[model samples]
Target chain A: EAGVAQSPRYKIIEKRQSVAFWCNPISGHATLYWYQQILGQGPKLLIQFQNNGVVDDSQLPKDRFSAERLKGVDSTLKIQPAKLEDSAVYLCASSTGQVQETQYFGPGTRLLVL
Target chain B: AQSVTQPDIHITVSEGASLELRCNYSYGATPYLFWYVQSPGQGLQLLLKYFSGDTLVQGIKGFEAEFKRSQSSFNLRKPSVHWSDAAEYFCAVGGKTGANNLFFGTGTRLTVIP
Candidate 1:
């Protein structure tokens, strides 16, 4: 089976700029997730979706970050007016939508906000 | 609420030697735990997870972890480290319902020397 797919493997932009990352989860997977990994740190959950609705996004920076899984298949995460602190790797993952299921991840999109 | 702690920031071990990485969590009741490995510029891969049943769980790439409820710890272990075992390891905790979950640690960087 194909693994989760993320676009724009890397991106660099000046502060205050906007950037977006796209993700295509593995086929048949119904649960999608977005995570951010800063340097020297582990991935932190940003948002989670079950079908087309969001299940959790409490940790997401609502003022700057927004994500959506419109069709409940592919998803997108956007960062507006990116800050230097936003420089990190954005990872996408998918699961079989069952409780305690294993999550499969993508290659991730590295963002460098200058 | 759930939280994880990785006591070690970095660990260096000689190849072919035994390895163990420590993890601790804070939660009111039983928690679902997971270990993931991330290579440079790549996404995370599941090493293993503990929900119930077994205290010692085996994972991919010759990795294994033992869940100790008495100590509130889940540590990864390997009998013989391989060169490719070098990566960043993260420990996460989640809820039993599997929604709005996965609190991760800062992570531990592992380096294997030949």
Candidate 2:
């Protein structure tokens, strides 16, 4: 079976510019997630979506970051006015929507803000 | 609320040597524990998890983990490591409610010397 898919495996942007990342989850998976992994650190959950509805986004930087999973399958994470600190790998994952289910991840988009 | 700690930032082991990576966690209750591996330029892959019952759990890629409640730890182990085992390993704990957020430790990077 195919795993989660993400677009633009790498991206580069200047500070204060805007960038967006996309993810297409595994077919039939009901839960999707976005995470940020800074160098030498583990991936941190940015947001989670269960069938197009947000399940948790408390850690998300609402002022500069936003995510949406419309129609419950495809998701997009956007960062406006990017900062140097925002340079990291943005990972997308999907699961069966069951509580505490195993999550499958994508290759991730490596964003470098100069 | 919940957090994880990986004491060792990096470890080097000869190929075919036994390997152990430490993981410590702080939680209010029995946590949903997991181990994930991430290769360079790749996504995170599940290695194993411990929900309850058995303290020791077997996982893919000849990996295993033992949950020690007294120690508040779940450490990943491999009897014989291969060069392919060189990657960043993460230990995570899932919250109990409200989407059950997953908290990750700053991963342990493994290098296998042939």
Candidate 3:
């Protein structure tokens, strides 16, 4: 089976600019998640979706970061007014929905906010 | 709020040597724990997870983790290290509530020496 797919393997932009990353999850997977992985740190959950509806996004900086998973398939994450601290790898993953199922991940989009 | 901690920021192990990575979590109820590995420029891949029953859980790539409720620990282990195993590893804890939000650790970078 194909793994999760992410576009724009890398991106660089100056502060205050806007950037977006796209993701296509694994086939037949119901749960999709977006995570931000800063250098020297683990991936933090930015938002989670189940069939187009958001499950959780409490950690997201609503002032700048936003994400949407339309049609419950592919998803997009946007960062407006990007700051130096926004530099990180944006990862997308999907799971089979079984409580014990493992999550498959994409290659991720590494963003460098200057 | 739930949280996870990986005490080791980095670790080096010779190829074929045994390896162990420590993880600790803080949660009020039964936790769903997971270990993920990220290769350079890649997304985070699930290594394993622990929910309940049997304290030990097996995972992909010959990885396994043992969960100890008494100590609030879910440390990962490998019988032998391989060069291909070099990567960043993260430990995460998921809440059991209906939403099941995950909290991740800072991560541990593993270096495999020939």
Candidate 4:
């Protein structure tokens, strides 16, 4: 089976510029997630979507970051006015809606803000 | 709130040597624990997870982790390491609440010497 897919494996943007990352999850998966992994750190959950609805986004930076999964199969995460601190790998993952189910991840979009 | 901690930032081990990576968690209730490995320029892959019943869980790539409630620790171990095992390892904890979002630690980078 094909795994989760993401676009633009690498990205570079100037500070204060805007950037967007895309994710297409595994087939039939009901849950999707976006995470940020800074250098030398583990991935941190930025948002989660169950189908077309958001399940959690408490950690998301409301002022600069936003994400949507309109049809439940694909997702897009956007960061406006990007900062140097936002330089990180943005990872996307999907799971089968069970708390215990293992999540499948995609090759992340490595964003470097200069 | 839930959190995970990986004490080691980096570790070096010779091929065919036994390896152990430490993890600790802090949560109000019992948590679902996980270990994930990320190769350079790749996505995170599930190594193993522990939900209930078994304290020791075996995973792909000849990896295993033992969940210790008393110590609030889940350490990954490999009986015989391989050069391919060189990657970044993350420890995470998931709670029942909030869409089961995972809390992850600062990762542990493993370097295998042949």
Q: Best-fitting candidate, measured by lDDT?
A: 2
Model 1 lDDT, full chain set: 0.91
Model 2, CA-based lDDT: 0.93
> What does candidate 1's lDDT look like per residue over A11-47, in tens digits?
9999999999999999999999999988887788899
Q: Is candidate 1 or candidate 3 better by TM-score?
A: 1
lDDT of 1 by residue, B1-114 (tens): 788999999999999999999999999988889999988877888888888898999999999999999999999999999999999999999864753367889999999999
Q: Per-prediction interface RMSD? A: 1.9, 2.0, 2.6, 2.1
So what's the TM-score on candidate 2?
Answer: 0.98
TM score of chain A per candidate: 0.99, 0.98, 0.97, 0.98
**Tens digit of per-residue lDDT, candidate 3, span B1-114:** 888989999999999999999999998888889998888877777888887889989999999999998999999999999999999999988766422466789999999999
- Candidate 3 lDDT (Cα, whole model)? 0.88
List each candidate's DockQ score. 0.69, 0.69, 0.59, 0.69
Residue B48, model 2: lDDT of 96
For each candidate, give its TM-score against the true structure.
0.96, 0.98, 0.93, 0.97
Model 4 alpha-carbon drift over 4 Å, by segment: none
Can you rank all candidates by TM-score, best first?
Answer: 2, 4, 1, 3
Instruction: Locate the minimum summed-lDDT window of 10 residues in model 3 chain B.
Output: B94-103
Task: Give lDDT: candidate 3, residue B11.
Answer: 99
What lDDT does each candidate get?
0.91, 0.93, 0.88, 0.92
Query: What C-alpha lDDT, on a 0 to 100 scale, does residue A13 get in candidate 2?
Result: 96
Clashes of each: 0, 0, 0, 0
What is the full ranking by lDDT, best candidate first?
Answer: 2, 4, 1, 3
Show the lowest summed lDDT stretch of 10 residues, model 3 chain A: A96-105
- What local lDDT does model 1 show for residue B6? 100
